[model samples]
Target: MRKIWLTGIAALAMASCTSKTSTPQPTASALAALPTTDWKSFRDTFIEDWFKVSPADAVYQGRHDFDGGLGDWSPAGLKRQGDFLRNAIAKAKTFDAAKLGKQDAFERDYLVTVAAGKLFWLEDADFPHRNPAWYVNAGLDPNVYIARKYADAPTRMRAMVSFLRKIPTAAAQIRANLKTPMPLSYVNFGVAAFNGFGDYYTGDAKKAFADVKSPALQEEFDKAAVAASKAMHDLGAWLEGQRGSATQDFALGADKFSRMIKETERVDVPLATLEAAGQADMKRNQLALVAACAQFAPGASVPACMAKMNANKPANNDPVAEARKQIPELRAFVLKSDVVTIPDQEQALVEESPPYNRQNSAYIDPPGPFEKGIPSVYYISPPDPSWSKVEQAGFIPGKSDLLFTSVHEVMPGHFLQFRHANASPSLFGRLFVGYAFAEGWAHYAEEMMWEAGLHAGDPETHIGQLSNALLRDCRYLSAIGLHAHGMTQEQSRKMFVEQCYQDEGNAKQQSARGTYDPAYLNYTMGKLMIRKLRTDWTATHGGRAGWKAFHDQFLSFGGPPIPLVRKAMLGGDGKAVF
Candidate 1:
């Protein structure tokens, strides 16, 4: 549930500016006279503007300042936000980052990056109009349900009612602002999602809203649900009417895509280099998959072995409990085997995927430092009772796959990495780092755990891990190719099926996902960067150091770009923390 906002390179560009006056340097006394309050004020304004534009983010951070409110997607709202960020960026450059303390300087740098990214998107990318997934109601989007956690039952119902009332206005703005094609497609998806929401409310609201069984409450809930349903349907109908005429390309051209990579991952590599790396990793994973298959079934070829393994998927039965049972065993194996330091404060709790989030198989909900007593929920989606056994089997993790997924989502992965981020010295750093780092580290952890022999007892576990890696690497290729290199959906699907060995259904779903989320490339790309970073650092620092020591040191600095990591760790001056 970590909402890592995307920071653009423009922010860093603002921070990197230096005055070029030929005047004599100021005296030490004069330099010291510059008030720290000025920089603090700048930081405060940036944070304030950030929260205003991203209220869902504030709610997630346990700040309910805008609990009942939603984002303003109107053209006027977008212009206002853009103007605010531009003004903030101009103000930010006046403060000297070097004169501030490390933490304050990091905050200033982050604020600049955030503002720059926002401005870039608004002015250059024109994402609000071009991306279909921008408004889709998906499990990955935390905005719709954030208020549910903060409010009581009646209050939650009221919030939903209020949210529903605004949906038409928001939809109108979306339609006005968006390019013809993408919004229609997105609205189709959004309508489909809203259908599921209606079902969820019908099933769960009875008990939850018991105290509100009066005619008034029922009427309000009914009206809201009906309005939501109608709006979604109407949107979908409108989208269908324009199907043949829709003409917005979702691609983020090479320059913008490259900039995104540089700003988000701090990598200087070109798209070609990333593609080559991903291809090589995919080949390596294929070889590993073959090797693993040979161990599992000596006479079977890799494809045959994978077919057998897929056919032998476990039956769905209390998936959450079954998944939970594997965690302690996996945790113990990881710790005893010296894979990575499992923090003492770690607490992994298994929970059913919220009815709203059932589409995703599972997700790690890591608690922030501010949420100390709150348990980290490893949300597992249980099979719908309506599903046939065969249909259900596809999602139920077999014992080996269960352990592998647990290790990736919980132990020594997301839960652990986030705990470290939460413990960071710079609150702004904890608050502002991008999703590439968080997701990339978790994906990276999956491979690192396998390398450390955490999957030793079961070769199938190794194969499962490799299969997952292949799918992710393929995702990297598909995301970059589709969004940046003009790759077609058919091409991406072929890549997934042929290289990643994914089933046709899953491959198709993933290809559709790419149209909206170009950053899906981050999982594999980020992980590869982290692994390469670790290898280079280890070679420089000697291989004798414990993995725990290396890992602790690496994560001690809040999740900065990998390039910045070198400066953070090696630049002992402590001023390069961000």
Candidate 2:
């Protein structure tokens, strides 16, 4: 909800560039239409409809046909889209499973899940009306055109211009549709986002197309982009005006929150059980931190040891440079340890995140699934220099903490895990990877790598990894607390500081993120599910040796919810998910 970016997708292309392999070729079976197969026809139309509603999704997915198209965000349009999903679900269920292949059936499950998530947000949760983010942020991927190279500069510029020209219309619909007295958090996020739209539309869009030699296209882009920015500025100012009336009633309530977990992720674990798991993980991390503190500093207080860790910040607080320097060493560590295969020599490019996209301090925008070979941009939003010294300092992470982030964002984390997903043989596996699996695996990688001798069991490194774990655990608690149990923002902020040991600045930011991103509990929730899967799965697959195999196999299913993937991976066993 606060649009916090949790996972960094390392463009595995850079990671995979050394292989000298060309773009993924559509197989004969994949390209040619088998009109007779219920699955193929259904899959084709399903993908078409997805692009039909969210053309930005097409741009991200590398489908250029819909690149310039925009969604109709009016109320009736949303219902039309919802109806399509409902009908699609019923149609998918009507197919006789006995006639479908193993993968086809699994794809059906993925299809249902995808449709359900869309319907839930539109119909159940009422995201379109209640949330400013739903409308103001539509088709607003800052790097969609900048990051991907699906086509030459001129052609892509034309597409971007086409899309930018539609922004005014989108803004008009949003102005008409969005309810006033929007959630305070949503309004604040919208104001910041739209204010940043000026820089993104005017400057970044131009830079992205700077190499374009087409004069006429450039002129069109200039005209379109200018108008788009004006629309955004007006919309943003309008939201600011409404901020006075914006209430803090943002929670999805108990019922919708539960359904969000159950339907979207296919997890039905009760809130109490989830809270217990989060608390257990937080305590475990705290105890580990205590032990690590003792080893790192035998007689120092917790605050003192943390000060030492914080002191390890980069020279002049240049995190971008530090992250760049660590890339090679992290890659080498993974290779030497057999933690997982690197598969290529391409590197993740680290940089300061764009202003509009800095809703979270750090995130990765990897090339979409259809992308062949492009750099995945991992972004860390260092604090604004204008902020107070204390605020700026909170944004600069310690050296060991930075390393764990590198692991989470790149090296054997989101980037590496996605490498396995990118190689999936099925379209469903390639496109439908679930958020829980993606973020969960990245979060889990931090501890898993440490256990595998990363940093040779250094206490500082353990503190960094455990600290991240504790942060995610607090996210789990804060999400359920905020949405289900009526936890106040002040209470959640205190929870972050007291339970997770977050600094005041970070505690404040993370607490607000929970107001909108209730599903963030997925970090710990998904990890626990994966851990359970590993314990049961590895016992029979052969204990230690089974890990690499598990990591590789787990990623191979694309990004499906673990439950769906689990059902297939474990011979239809679903008990482990519950």
Candidate 3:
């Protein structure tokens, strides 16, 4: 959850520059006097600062500039970064956007938006010091796997050693910043992950470090390994101190939550409105699920139908291998359907999720620049080998349910849309849009795929997709309820299990996740907004447009809010800017 930073003054100024310019006017004195070169310089500097603040983010994005440097989450460091962002914002405001070219204007708009968002977080939210997951999850371990694919083995090992060495300092900052009513659930999860990670290193360290002939490197790796063990120990001890005292109430209160909706998502709807919309969607999806279930198992109840569907799922010697086998077919379906345009260079690889990165079942690894041909990974969590079949079944995607998660996480979803985004010409488009739109587009894409007849041959498949939709709709409602309506975790879990028909264990995990990720609401909210935008766009264009054209145009602007999409497509300014 890295914050986007920039100011409104800069946006307004840049917008003014982009207003209906008649001619190129290359020789104009105003353009000549503008700080165009300075703006590009500033943009690079800002990106560098951004990489410095979140080095793990850089590695994830395939930037090896800060390979060995871990991010500092200390309060002093956060304040320093905040101060830097504020100063950058102030400097950005001084630029005379009225005299700049189109590219410069776009850059200014993006910088301002990013800077303002950062300043808002620094001043209004306790997020910097209060969230322990931010630090715990932002580690070098996950990136090591990705980076190792590209870097030499020894260089990769050295980077790992350097990263492990910083754990003590990183863990100390986390301990120092522990707020009242600590995020104990997240702490417990983090401790579990750290403990698992320590075991991974301890068992594999010698092999990973075997080729390093230098004694200095060997000693450094040993020292770092010891430090990491200590850090994990300290973290567990600190987590134990706040066990029963963790806050059960997950509300962000109305004002702050609303601000999040507006600033991060650029959604104009109130939280209550979003909640109402989610409930309606929940009901609609529930009905659809019931209808699909009845079609699959005539006259059976929803649960009975689900049991039948689950019963018929493919048995496997390796559940993870079976899941992996399904991915290529899904990707092929999305590509052949032409629902969304995917990059020619984008590599969609499936990898097992590391223990440290397994809070969720799957996530899309970020891509690098299109020119360099960076690959996107669809990370699937392998079932624990020691778990019973019953325990393992909870994670293994049922055959009928496989495409739903596939569409959401991979093709015609995050991976597909992000490839387009990374290749976007607008640097601001490349950097500054919100995750709500990004995640929302993916969620929307999943539903849209079904609507386009993805699983028309199988009623059970449709039921599974609808059930997943119900789950997300419930997430939207639960997120709003927990953060805007003061719903307790128990209450949230109950709502999910009862209405969403999620298993008890899954319900509990989702509820706990919502405490830290309130913006989970965006999946449904964004999808609904995208649907509305599509309908409006279709109606205005005589409903004659092809889905490919519509979807391509929609995604081409990167992941701006649906409202911004409407403005870009229908405002008739003819600029076609994102």
Candidate 4:
């Protein structure tokens, strides 16, 4: 139930000099310098202020100088951060995009969206004070210092100790800031995760950093960790008490939800349009699934067919190892098929996800765009041993499912797309990676690889790809349904089982996820956006044969909202996104 937030200006302090041509320029665009240089002054003051409010994120992003400090959740501190965002947004308006180059204009647009997104969260939604989940997700991880190896063991251990020391203050702020009569789902999530994290901090997390040999540092860590664990335990105890009294009133509502979509993603489409699109995708994938099921086994029930497919899962049911086995081959497929360029020389290392980071079964942990020469992590969390046998079975995906996930996480998906991003001359390209663009390209890459004959269009391969597609489709429907249409968790869970063919365990997990992460809908929504953009851009540029050309062009801009990317790619933004 973590909120998706990245609160910083695009790239203000890094670039000090704007590039200008000496020769006679074609127009104002040719004469115009990269606005990044001019905007550099804003980033310096902004980032310093930002780090003060969100030090853990700064350290997580490899800004080790901001090490050891926890975020300020007190009223005065919150107001200071809010005012900082307002001023940054106001300053961003002064950049005259009319005289700037195409790249500069795009950068300007992106920076505005980033500012607007931050403002929307702080002022509009006011999530910090309202949502209790923020308190948990924000301070829930004292183990990040152990998780990331940006520095040596001793240094990281010290940072961990400092973070641990700050936990009591952070927990006190959480107690003070949270409003009562909390949403049942949010309270339940906080109770489970916060309590579970307290256990992790006391045991597994301590084990992770136990290798640091300095006895003095160890003594400091022991004391700090004890205090941090108690803080979490106390926070969890309070939340557990509230859970019984919590009610189901978690929707972002229509206006704020609509504004959320617009300000964060630049998708101005109506809710009905989004729901209709999702329903259509669900039906489309269902038909494809039916056909694939038919091809796999003639006239079998969907469940029976799925059971047969599920039984074809990994030998030991270890997706992490299976992912490691398949990724090199997936890369070979990319080169053979020539779908998109693979600029990533480094491969994503597969491993178990950290204890604090195991909300989903699997995820790719990419380095921040400013980070280079660092290996990307593709973390696969196995089913908790506490789960029942049937539940554990549901956690294990079929081999083909793992293959598509590998394609999405590595090779020509996130990892490869990011390599092109890092190569971008625009700092905006590197820094301002949007959720829509990143998830869209990764999602699009799944089907694109299949279209390029990943398994020669085999039926099982189709089943795997379509199953993932349907899951995303269900997410799209459930997001709209739960938030905009008043759909209950039970109803959303039923939709997953009925339409997406998800297992009981997965259905519950996904349904509960939509309660907190409405933006999970972006998987299908973003994939479709990329598909439409590709079809339109490729038609005029070259036809289907220009797949690689379209992909290279699309990924070259790094991650901006699809609308801005569309405006850049198509020469103008239109009313109809699709």
In lDDT terms, which candidate is top?
Answer: 2
The window of 10 residues in a row where model 2 has the poorest summed lDDT is: 13-22
Candidate 2: count the clashes.
Answer: 6
| TM-score of every candidate relative to the true structure | 0.82, 0.91, 0.85, 0.91
The candidate maximizing TM-score is 2
Q: What local lDDT score does residue 536 receive in model 2, on the 0 to 100 scale?
A: 72
Task: Give me the overall lDDT of model 2.
Answer: 0.74
Candidate 1 off by > 4 Å? 1-37, 120-123, 136-152, 155-159, 183-188, 197-207, 211-225, 244-248, 344-360, 366-372, 380-397, 540-544, 572-578
lDDT of each: 0.61, 0.74, 0.64, 0.73
Candidate 1 lDDT tens digits, 1-578: 23233431111011111111111212223212223357765565456555556544544454433343446777766766677767776777776768877666666656666566566666676767765345542112333233234444555566555555555665676567767655333444444454444445444543456566467866786776566556645655655666666543667878888876654455667678778888898988999888888889889977677666666554445667777777888778777877566657567888776564444457766543443355677887766455566545554655566666677778777778777776676655565555566667778878877777775647777877887788788888988888788888778888887888776555655676666666778778778767766775677676735566678777766566555565555553322111
TM-score of 1: 0.82
Give the range where candidate 3 is weakest over 10 consecutive residues by summed lDDT: 8-17
| Candidates 1 and 4 compared by lDDT, better number | 4
Clashes of each: 1, 6, 8, 1
Query: Residue-wise lDDT of candidate 4 within 145-233, one digit each (tens)?
Result: 66556667777777777777777887888888878888777776677677777777778877877888889988988898888889888
lDDT measured at residue 149 in model 3 versus the true structure, 0 to 100: 54
Off by over 4 Å in 4: 1-37, 43-48, 135-144, 384-387, 574-576
- lDDT string, candidate 2, 159-184, tens digits: 77777877887888877877888878
